[model samples]
Each structure stands twice: as structure tokens, then as C-alpha cells.
Target: MSSNFTNTYTIHMLCANKYEDILTQFSSPIEIEDLWLAALTEWCHSPTAQCNLGTNVPPNSRIACTDPWYSKLRWITLGYHYQWSERVYNESKVGEFPSLLYGTTVNIINFLKHLIEGREISSNNSSRLLEQCQNYTPEASIVNYYRTKTTMGFHSDDAEVDKEAPLVSISFGPTALFLLETSEAIKHEFDAPLHGSFDHVLPIYLHHGDVVIMAGKSRLARHAVPLIFFDDDTEVVSKGALRVSHNVCDKIVKEDHNEGVCIHCQECLTYIRTTRINMNIRQVMPVHR
Candidate 1:
């Protein structure tokens, strides 16, 4: 990551209670449109949400959905909100985790369990896997939005209270160059006290719909998104939109009740052409603790 390039982003936090109080804090207070409020409340019992749209902008300025602020949104946090500056999850800021995301993550973990047990996932014997996933609860998520020239610096996800649980990451939109490195490799590159191997670094190309699991010994491995390949191809974007448009439309429809007010798939196609979205989910609390 370039030290000179400032990381611009916004955070949408799910707050189950005090929805009205939180909204009042915004300089130019905005309501959580009815549809979104309903969806959030239904999925996580969060009646309100909080959004921090960077420090550079005027706090009292009313931000429209089509404003430049939306494009600058880099990340959103759900469930237990993470304090980036402090590198810790605020226990008091917790909210109910989204069920849909949790279910999807559980399914992914089940597949991983089958691989570990030396069983074919297609064998349809998921009873054992389902039982194992019962222990994994997704308490937090970081949704990263990457635009052109956006990059994530090398870092380890050690803020969670439980480091043993697997970390799941889902990718969408354009492809990105993901770099995974060992702790020793990071030390060597930074010229830290211990001499480490540079060979431990691995570069991976992640395309849309790809899932990455960091578990076992690699749970806290250092990783980074060094680059994103934004393909301006219309066909590619259209296909990509088709893959996620239903979910997007569903959410939008729930947020607005207007009979004809709906975001078309074509709008999603246009958005896909310029960005990549990554959903990084993790269990922030220890099950045994």
C-alpha cells in the first residue's frame, strides 16, 4: 500500500437499539429509508444504522444516494463493530448478526469440514458437518469496497477474541491480486528482529464468487489486496450483475415501497464495472470462553 494514498471510506454499523438517537447525531440527519430499516430489523433486529462518511466532508451536509460520498465508501461493519483505530471490537456496540450471511458462512464451513474429514462434499452426508458448524458463529463482518487504484495493505486479522475459528472471505465484482504471507515473511520484509523467508509469500488471483478460508495454522496469516483488475467490458459486468442483482434488488425493494421504484440490473452492471466488493466474516468471540 502507498503511504501517501489516503484510504477513503464510510462505515455502516447495525445498532439494534437507539436507532433514533444515532440518526440525530448525523450533521445532516438522514432517515434509514423504510425498506432498509425493515430488512435490517428483520435480519438482525437492528432498527437503526450508523454511517460515518469520512472526516473530510462537512458533517451537516445532506448526502444523497447518488452523491460522491457513496462512491467513496470503502467499508461497512455488521454485528460487532470493529474499531479500526483501536484494533478491537467494542463489546457494547454489538448487534444481532445477519442470518442470511451466517447461513451462507455455515454452508461454506460445512464444505471445508467435509474436505478435512476426507469425504466428498457431493456425497450428501452433511449431518456431521452441520453439527461441527454449530460451534462457529459469525459475529462480525467487514465489507470492503475497492475502486480503481484502491489497495489494502498487508495485515493480520488478530483483533478477534477467538483466533482459532476460521475466517471466511467472499469476493465479487472485478478480480484482485491477493497476497498471503507468513508472519515470518512479514518480519523479513519489514526488517524486523527475526530473519524470515520471503518465499513464504503467495500471490493469488481472486475472481467473482470466490471464497477464501483462513483457518488452522494460517488463521492469523498476513494478507493484502495489492491490486484489482477492473475490466471495463460490458459483457463481463452484465454477467457479474446477473449473479448478484437479485439480492441487491431484494434489499432495495425492501428499503423502498414505491410501486415502480426499483434498481434495475443494468444499474448494477454499471456499478460492477468500476468496483470490487469483499465480505470478510469472522467469529469475534470465543465459544469456550
Candidate 2:
């Protein structure tokens, strides 16, 4: 199994060694492995369901959107009903989500603030002056979704994010394959060679306890889930498990109101997007005149 995951084949496991050194410390797969994110899974799954995260499509919408950036990403469009978005985004966001899950986004966002901080940050009322960004143009949150059996088109991380920002994410429920294709050339050079190799098509086997770190050129590198299979692996599936992950990125944008979420959004509610949680964790800088 170790050899199958070497640099020669799929993604170079930057965290494999990190994971190996500590994976066994726990009794079972626990979110705590990823520390902050682990706690989040428990927090999100809890009854409170306070959420700053959500999938763009319907809970059962079989639609899959392709990456406007790549074609291999098309392969990930399986089980996905369609592969596009038609709504225009606007200025107001963070107040309404899922419409089905309205009022919950705020709780989730506040929770994120608390997560980033070392200490606790209670809601507005109990603020011990722990922290406050009290007023800031909310970074337009552009969210898409991946459903069970749905594939994410292959392409580099989103373009909305400016260069030099880390993509923080959160995952919840249902296991899926996350593929990161990094060939020898692409690994080090953008124009070195357009070699099509599965070397980077790494399926991030996520299940509850998983965190994806996207930064540097690696952040610019291509990634996606070409396909989703139940019991995709007899070994892992027979045990009855699924992968879920979500996170925040360090990117900010003004809701165009003219160009709504391109992948998944309110007008596209009937999308039937899966129930996976994705968030952004990045430092936002105000635009300079």
C-alpha cells in the first residue's frame, strides 16, 4: 500500500509521513488528528448545526459542475446531472444560505472566528473583548458543491483567490476520492511540459477526519475528484465508511450580484448538491485606490 502511494504514481504525500508518524496514536479515525478541523466536524455534526459552510446543489441533486479551467475536470462530472451555473451573484451574502438552512450560516461563521483564535470567542453578547472584525465588507463567499457519485473537474485551485494565499478547508461526512495530478514538470514548472500523468491525480481518501492544505504552486496545481464510487475500495468500504471535509480559504471578493455563484448558489438551489462543507481561510486585504 505504501509503495502504491509513492511519488512515481499519484500525488507525493506531503502529509503521508506526517500522518504515518501519528495516525496510530488514536484508537480510531478521529477528527482530532487534524486538531482544529476535527473539532469542527464534531461541532458541525452536532445538533447545533451552526454552519458557515454548505454545498451549492441540493442535498440529492445529481448535478456536477466542471472546472472552467480544465477538461480532465470534465471526467469528474459523473453522477452530476449538469455541469454549469446560470445565476449572477450580488452584494449581500452570509445572511441567507440553503434557504433551507437559513440563519445557520451566521453561527457557522462565528464558529470559524473562534476556531482561528487560540482562545474562545463567544458570540457578540459575551465578547470578553477576545476579538472583533466588527465591520468589514464580507468577502463574497463563492461556494460550489460535490455530491455523492459526482465528479469535480480537473483544474488548479480557484482563480478568485489572489496569488500567495493559503486555502483552508473543512470536511464533513461521506467519503470521496480527491485527486491531485502533479507531474514531474508541472510539479516544478508551469510550462515545463504538458505531460498528462496521473502522478498527481491523488484521491484524497477523506472520511470525517481530513484536512487539505493548498498553497504555493501546489495551490496553483491541478486537482479534482474524477469520480465517486461507493465502497470505491472494498477494503475501506466493507467497513462502512465515507469521507467528508471542508475548509476556508484566504480569498476575498465583492458579490457581483451580477454574477452570482458560478458553481452553486441560491437560484440554483434545486441543484441537489451533496452535503459536504467547504470554507475559506485567508487574509483579506482591502483594495487600494
Candidate 3:
């Protein structure tokens, strides 16, 4: 977990045992987590299903699934839905955070504490690190889907009130080139000439099952995803790995169809092949100490 960047740790292949399970939960047609996706036909009738697209569609408009909305899908919020325009989380537009995701985040935080304790650090430092790990709460998440050519620009996640809590980022699918820079370093670079070099930005390669934790001093660091490697060997989903309930499968296919037929799983695998999914989880509120 050692990293060149202070307070930034990288755990390679962190979710080896449960990677497939995590992917199935998100990629399967049966949505396990309550995702607030824009223009999703199933949620069109709900009051919280306001579309984020810059289209002329009414607030409660019911757009057909046949439209090319899926291709336009980029990101979706979970639990506390973030208002992108305002860069804030609305308390009223909140939902239950996924149990599986919450458990995984807690485990990672505990593991981080264990790693710190094993180091030859002072007792005071070790105690402070343990306290930070124990105080984290997974309150919200943003699931971002990236195509091969897609890229995220440099930005700092400063909307969350709980700055001390670490921001855990989990990656799936092909590897990506992630650039990270400290807030102070970014400010100094901005003062330089227009064509000045950016030598302080650290490039991190995030692969499938990799986890990045931004905590302590690096909590508000500016970061971006400049590129994603199109690796054919990247395992998106295994055959028969997705466990769809019988009732849910029935809704996907005809009642008289073959017993083992599952079109949903096939479509899910195909979509994941060319897409990279990143689950960025964080605490939106201060911990009541």
C-alpha cells in the first residue's frame, strides 16, 4: 500500500475474492443497489427521477427504453444523490447505501489501519491513524462508467463536509492511467506560465480490482483519468458467474423459453467488455464524535 504521494495509498487487487460478485451486482439487469440514473425508463414515474440530460424532456417524462439512452449513460449516484450543477448533496434525495459496498469499504479501512500499525511508526501516530480509520462511514457513492476514449478532467472532490474521512475508489474492467496532484502543488502550477510543465503530477495505473484511498493530506487532492488501457485479457465477467433470481430471469425472457437461457447476463457481459466501471465511495457528513 506504500505510495509516493503522502496520505494516498494504492492497494493492488484488493477485491480478488469478491470481484466477480461485485461486478455482477452492478452489471446485472436486476439492480441490487438503488441507483439514481438519468433517463432510466423504470424510474421515470418516481418523483426523484429527474433527468440530468440537457434535453427538452419534462421532469416526469416517460421515455421509452428503445431510445439510445443507455449509450449516453456516463455516471450514476448512489445513496446521497449529488447535484452536479450545484456540486452538493441533497439530504432529501437520499437512499440506502448498498450493504455489500458499505461492508467492503469498512473492511478496507480496517486493513489500512493494520498496515499502518505494522510500520515502525510512533505510538501517537499509530493511534491517530487508527482513529481516522475507525471514524469513516460510507454514506454515498458515484458509479462512473468509462469507455475506451472517455476521460475525466482534473478536479478536487471538495463537496463533502467530512474532509477527514478517506475517499475510496474501486476500479473494474481494463486498467486506467490516473493522475494525482496535491492541492498546493496545483496552485503553484497555476501561477506558472501558460505552457509551463506539470512535472509534479503522479501517474497511477489502476487495474481491475485495484483500490485507491485518498485520506489525510491527500483528501482534497486534484486528480484525473487521462487514459484507459484496452486490455483484451481484462476479465469483465465469467460465464454463468452472474446469479439472476428465477423470477427476475422470467421477466427478462419469455415464459416458454429455454430453461437455461439468460439474455440479461449476455447483454451485461457485452456492455462491460468495452466499459470500465469505477465506484467512488465517500462520507458526505461529519462523524459524530
**What are the Cα lDDT values of the candidates?**
0.55, 0.32, 0.56
Give candidate 2 misplaced runs (Cα > 4 Å): 1-145, 183-195, 229-289
- Per-residue lDDT tens digits of candidate 3, residues 75-106? 65667888898999888978666666787788
Residue-by-residue lDDT tens digits, candidate 1, 1-289: 2111112111111011100101111111011122122222232223322334533332322222234765776766778988878999988988666676777677667656655466433223335333434588888987787877889999999999987677888665677888777543332335434434445665566654456667655668787998888873434334435434433444455534333335563354355456677878999987876
Question: All candidates' TM-scores?
Answer: 0.64, 0.38, 0.66
Task: For residues 141-217, write the lDDT of model 2, one tens digit per residue.
Answer: 32334455556677654433243333434333345566665444224223444435643444456543334444334
What is the number of residue pairs that collide in model 2? 52
- Which candidate gets the maximum TM-score versus the true structure? 3
By lDDT: ranked, best first:
3, 1, 2
Scored by Cα lDDT, where does model 3 land? 0.56
Extract clashing residue pairs from model 3.
none
Please state the error at residue 114 of candidate 3 in Å. Answer: 1.6
Ranked by TM-score from best down, the candidates are 3, 1, 2
